[model samples]
Structure formats: C-alpha cells, structure tokens
Target chain A: MENSVDTLLPTLDDGIKCSAITSTDGLVLAHTGSGATLDEDFLGAMGAALFAFGSKSIANLVGGKMKDIVVEGEQGFVKVTILNDKLLMVTVAEPLKLES
Target chain B: MQQATTSISAVQIAHNIEKRRLFIEKPQSQAHVTNMKDAPIYKTRPAVLQRAQNQDRTPLLKGEPVKEVKIILAGNVGSGKSTAIRAISEIPVIGSDAKAIERNALHNKESTTVSIEYGMAYLDNSNLHIYSTPGQRRFDFMADVLCKGAHGMVVMIDNGCRDPLNEMDYYLHQHGRFLQNYPGIIAITHFDDNNTDTSLLDYSTYLLKHGLACPVVSLDARNTLEIKQVLMNLLLQIGDFKTGKKRA
Candidate 1:
C-alpha cells in the first residue's frame, strides 16, 4: 500500500510546490519538493497548529470536524490535510479549485 | 526562621544522597548489612520505593516542541534494570519485579521480568520514554520491539552477578549493531556489596578492548539522585551528538 510517508507525499501531482508529511506532534517525517523560501520545519509546526485550530473551530461552529484547510495568500495557497489521527500531509501549491 | 538564602539546590540534594549512600555502604559491624548476599536480588530503598509509589500524576508536556527520546535499559538478571527505571521515572512505572515461577526460564534462575518495564522522564521540553529490557536471553525477541525508537541506552551491569563482564559482553554483542548509532552509558551497580575492586575504569577498559566505547559510571540503584545523574549524562551526550560537538 502507499500509506507510508515517503510513498504518500511524493506521489502527489506535480502541482505541489512543497509537500511535507509530518506526525500530529509536528515533527517532519518526510518532505518532498521544498518551497523556494519557506522553512520546512517551521512550516510543519505552523501547519500542525493551523490544522488543530481548523479541526476545533469546525467542531465547535458546525457540528463536525475539519476535512482540510485551504489558506490562500497573494502568491499561492497552502493546504493542510489530516491523513490520519497520527499523521497529516501538508502541501503548498499554486491556486487551484477543489473540484478541478 | 525566614529561609531565603539557605535553600537547597539540586546539586546539594544530590550531594546529600551520595553521602548517605556512602555511609550505608561503609563496612559496619551490623550483621544484616554484612550478610546482604543471602538477601533478595533487588532491594530498592524505602524513599525510592515511596517515590515510585507516589508517582501517578501526568507531567505537563503540552504545547511544546518535545523530542521523544526513547531509551532502553538492558543488562543481566538482577542488574537493577527495573530499579533504575523506577528511580528516575516521573510517572509510576508500568512494571514491577515479581517472583518468577518458570524454569528453563528467562535467566535460568529465579525472578524474571516476563514483560518490559515502561517509564518516562521529562527534561524541560524533551520527554524520554524509558524501557527496561528483560534480562533473559529467552526474551531477546523483545529487544527489537523495545528499541523501536530508542535515542540512547543505559546498560546496567551488576558487579555482584557471576561473571558480570561476560554478561556485559553478551549485551554488547547482542545490541551493539543497532546501539552504535546513538550514545550509551554503562551503570555499574551493586559494587558496594560486591566489593570486587570494580570501578568505572574497568568497564571502560573492557569496552575499549572490544572496540566499543561509551561512558561508564558507578551507580547506586537505591539512590534516585544518582539515577537522575545518569539520565542527565545521557541527555548531555544526546545534546552533544545532535550539535556535532566533540564526544569523550
């Protein structure tokens, strides 16, 4: 299966400028295609915090948990997706529609 | 009566504990003290045992960049593996040394650790998960399982045990392949009662002779302060290894 960290993140489409697989504790397990100017460790840590915030906020406001989070910046977007309770995948890529 | 400047530091506490251990180890006229060979294999001090019993609260480690440092404590039977874990663990250790009932048993002797001993020690934001490997060769299967993510190890050698040097060699031969990646320390226990003129230098020499290297220090299993010192040494070694500093 492709559930392992190395296989999971690198297999993502080429649109991802940077893809980091990290534990829920915010430690980077595996990372592929680093951002030109972004710090990988700091990105993983902040992505973990952002994911926690999104998870809790959705749980409180709506009635369920957050599927993923998409933050759009001037240059591009960052997506934090929870792979499992113990693992998560963070990807930085150019703007793209969710359905597309 | 107002005490502000006359407070005890951790170093002072450690010094006091060492002094007490030295006093207890002194050759006295007391019969029971001299005849400890017939006593049980493990004798944890009253204070250490009480501390182990009282340790039940979860240490606060949330919202921090914590490094999960797993350390495996391995040695022969009755080498005080479990005692070391309990002495340093901030939480109540998961396993207790029970009387053994099986022969062709773990150690070909009485009293074995049928399972692994689990403990945790927290240093600032770095959290260490300590596992005491069962001493019997029969339980060698548990080595890989226990050492899954061990950052380092502290091997306890009982000077009182028969041919402790051979036992030490056995451990080195068994785990040296994997343990070379990280730093380790040797804790020579029971030297007080065993009194074979064994020193930390003896262990260091053996390791050097075998081309294996690590720090060797005498340890009093009953002293929590001494156990903490061993842990501090390992943590410092880890820090040195991580920072690419020169290692002794």
Candidate 2:
C-alpha cells in the first residue's frame, strides 16, 4: 500500500520537492521528492506532531473537524492533510516564487 | 472512590458556595475578587468554559495560541479520582457511574467510572481541562486515548491501600515515559486514614531512590483547597519546565 503512495508523488508540481505518507504514530510509510534537507524521520515525526496538535486543539476549542494544516517556514513549507483515520499525507515544498 | 456519595448534593459547589473559602493561599484570587466588590459573581459551574477565543491567527505556521491545557488523573479504584474532580471542577463533571463488581465491591461505596470524567478550571484566560482515567486495567485502551497531548498528570495513590508504595511504582512504571515527556506529580489520597508503616517521606525517599523526582504531597481529595494546591504545584512545575527550571 505504501508503494502505491510512493508512485504518485512525481506527478506533483516542481515546487513540491518532498511528499510522504506517515502514520499517526510518526512512522514514515513512503516518500518521494527531495526539497527537504532534514532527515525523513525528523520530517515524519514533525508532521505527526503538527497534525496531532492541530486536530486536538481544533477539536477542543472550536469543536470542529480539522481538514488540513499548513506550516510555512523561512526555509520551506510543510503541508499536512488527513488521508484516513490512521494516516496523513505531508508535503514539504518551496514557495511558488510569484511571477512578479 | 472512598468518598463516593450517592447524592452529590453534599459535594455540589452551588450548595457549598458559602462554605468555599476559595483558598486564601491561592494567590491573586482573593485580591481579584475583593477588587470586584467582594461578591463572588462567577459560581463555579459547567456553563463557564474557560476558553480564550481572542487568539491571533497569523497564518498556520507562525504559532498557535494555547487556549487550554489538558491534565489527566490516574489512579486505582477508590483513589478519589472521581471525588477530587467533583470537589475542584468549576463545572459539573460529565461522566457515568456503575455499581462496583467483583473485588471492587469489597471497596465499600459502590459505583465505578463508566467512562472518562471531564472538568475545567480557568487560569489567566486559559482553560485547565481535567480528565480522569478509569481505574480498572481493562480500560487501559481508554487511558491511552485520553492521555494523548495532556500537559501534565496528577497520579492519586490511596496510601491506606495494601502496599501503596507498590501501587505508586505500578502507576509510574506504566506512565513513566509519559510523565518524562510531560510534567507530573504524586498526590497521596486518604492521608487521614493512612495506617501504613510508611510516611510521606517514605514515598519521597522511594521516588528519589528510583531516580524519579515528581513532587509528592498529602491531600484530602474531598477538600477543594488541598486539590487546588496539588493543581497549582503541577502548574508551577509546568511553568518551570517552560522556563528551563529543574523539574520538581
């Protein structure tokens, strides 16, 4: 199943440097792209933590479901989207560099 | 719990409002109330959710405001996990109770935690979400689910129970990693009835010997003042952790 996820990442936009599927427990199941300089393990753990925090905070405060979370850093951006009850998809990418 | 009352009427804060001294030891609270005309306006109740809605949402990545803190209560049957919550919770605790079964029936007062218990307290506009884990081991699965992302925990130990030191050991062993990841304290319940060969020092000694430094305190779970002390201690420890102070 992870192999299937790995096969779908190259089709993303050029700025989409890294994409991976991670379990809710912080385990990286599959990966593609390389815009991220940090280790995949660290990236996966971070994705899990961010998702968990976002989901729980929203659940308790807003009392609503969390659809997705986007974290932007000076270096790059990390996007986490829920894929299923037990898995989330994280995309690490650079800014699109506006056509200005 | 040892103090389980069939009718919570006796423990109801609305009825005991006059009786609540509101902990003179509780800093800022006395002054805050006195400056507000000395009339207690906010009757500790469920409708008052201590949540701060005015958080700066500067995009998703910069930072997220801490609207509340989650704390878990872990202990065995009759450790007063239920009563402590009732005594201190500003809101009516939301949970079910059932008649005790098996060896638990011998523990005196009936009823077991049917599910997670929730209570809340407001501190500096941030909500303190208190959650109680069921005492039965069969409910371990539920404990895992309830404990995730909790900022800290207060592990209650019925010191009068058989070999309470071992009980403390068991709980810490079960959650040592979790506590290490977060701040936690040891609350000795049933201290008045404690007839054991050990004292508070013994518990502290043992924790120190085992390389654990979680603060230990004697508290009557039925007394709101003592419960607040325990909560305040844990809160301070969490603050200390944030500021790089040595763990208490």
Candidate 3:
C-alpha cells in the first residue's frame, strides 16, 4: 500500500507538484520529483525541525496531536499532512491553481 | 503759653522716637530655629521674595517612547486576506477594493495598492500595527512593497474553493522568496462551506514540502474567538523563533 502510494505521488497532478512521505522521526520514507538545489539532506533536516516545531506547538497549546501544517513563502508553498500515528505526507508546489 | 508749647513739642518728639524703635526692632519671641541647617539656606541671597521666584528653573525631559510590533498580511486575491487582518485588529480597518478600479487586465496599475488598509491591536501588552495588501494579482507589485520590513506575515487561503492547493501555490510564488526566512501563518479561511473536502493533514503535508516551519489553522474570519486563537498561535511561533526553542 505504501509503495503504491509512493508511485502515485509522482504521477499525481501538478497541484501535488512535489511529494514526500517522512517518518515522525523526520526520515524520508519516499520522495518524488525534484526540490530546490540547496541540498536534499539539508532540506530534510529543516523539514524535521519544522515538524518538531509544529508538533510541539499543537501539543503545548491545545494538548492535541498536530494533524497538518502549512508554511507559505515567496518561492513556493510547503504542506505537511499527517497520515497516521507515525507518518506524514509532504508536498511542495509553485502557485498552481487547485480551483478554477 | 511757652510752657504749653514746649509740652506739645516734647509729646511729638516722644511719639516719633517710639515709631523709630518699632521699625528697627526684630521679633525675638517667635519659634526658635530647631537646627542651624533649617535656617533659610538659599544658595544666593534674594533682594526680595519675588526676585527669588524669577531664578532659572530646572530643565524638564520627555519620558521614554513606547515600542510597537508591525505585522504584514500578504496573500492572493479572494484569499480572505483583508478579513484575516480585520480579525485581529482592535481598531477599524481601512482597505481598498482594487478590482473595482482596474477593470482591464492587460494594463497593470503601476501602483498595485490603490489604498492602504491598516489597523492596530495589542497582543500580550505589545502594540501591533497590522496591515493588509490588496490581494489581486495586478496589485502584487504594491503587495511586495507592503511586505517589505514586515516582522511577520499571515498568508490566508480559501479552503472551500475548488483549488486550495493552487491558491497556496500562488501565495508561494508571490511572497515565498521574500518571506523565506521570516515567520508566517497559513490561514485556511471559508471553512464554513458545505463542499469543503480538504483536511488539515492534507494541507500540512503541502506546507512541509515547502520551506516553512509554521502552523496551518482553520480560521473563520467572522468569528473573533477563533481569530484570537490564530493570533496566539502566530505569536507562539514567533516567540519560539526568537528564543530558539521548539514550539511545543
């Protein structure tokens, strides 16, 4: 099921421009498409940092689990979707219209 | 007759001497000076009490000035950007509808901001100046100018729309470059719609892939309480960034 989901990621519409499945520990389980040339490892580290921040924020505030997190920037948008207890689906996209 | 005249002269002389004595004598029976230092010790002797009052007065200085935080609201058109700003503002909001002015698309307005929309709010006793840019694409140039020097950004998205992902993309393309290092919030507005299909998890994954380490919250622009929570979350994120602590 996980492999099928991974294969479907790259073939997914442009709206899901770039996709990745990362563990709660911040390790990449699957990634499709290219990211900014800055460095994949460095980007992974940053993603972990963000995940930690989001998780902690939700936990500390509402005393609930963090289900999703989104960060917008001038170059692109990053979305972190919580799948189950220990996995997250991440996607990066340029300004593409999901709705007409 | 001579004797009577001498007597009158003597009486007049006695009266004049008594008057002179009264003028020269100082009252000695008044309260005794408790301490030598208590004696009127003016640095300079005054010719008169009125003269002492005219001496140079001490200079007065102004008090310390108050500091305020500036927050910028930037995003794409129909993103509820203005409503998001209004949510946190304590004062009345001043906004413009740029779509009304430039009916044509080809001729872009040189000044993207037709009018400025700003409001003031107090968060944690800290004064905040919140401003929103016109979300139209033609006004993007003006939005960039507005975004410059902002301490934070609140990027709003319409969640119920057919293409929220696309809206996210537009926001990134427009402000992602400038806001790469700055802290921000992704507000998914219009959640009250019946056809809302996206979940919080779906949105979060989208944001994680981008370089932002912020919170994605569902916001109902019309609800003040919900807005306050969103603002609190934004502040918490900012505090974490400054203190180098994990948000949790």
**What TM-score against the true chain A does chain A of each candidate get?**
0.81, 0.85, 0.74
Best by TM-score: 2
Positional deviation of B49 in candidate 2, in angstroms? 24
Error of 1 at A70 (Å): 46
- What's each prediction's clash count? 0, 0, 29
Pitting candidate 1 against candidate 2, the one with the higher lDDT is 2
lDDT of 2 by residue, B105-203 (tens): 326756666457789875533468999987755455557788888889999998788888888887887787776557787887786676676666677
Which pairs of residues collide in candidate 2? Answer: none
Per-residue C-alpha lDDT of model 3 across residues B68-132, encoded as one tens digit per residue: 66677766555565666677677877543322233243123332223347888665434668887
- Cα lDDT tens digits for candidate 1, A1-100: 3356577775446567888987553557788776678667766665665665576568767977678899999778888998877567898887665784
- Model 1: residues >4 Å from true position, as ranges? A1-100, B1-64, B96-98, B102-111, B195-197, B245-248
* The 10-residue segment with the lowest total lDDT in model 2 chain B: B45-54
lDDT tens readout by residue for model 3, A7-62: 73545466555677765434566777656753433333345445655776687678
Better of 1 and 3 by lDDT: 1
Query: Per-model C-alpha lDDT, please?
Result: 0.66, 0.67, 0.56
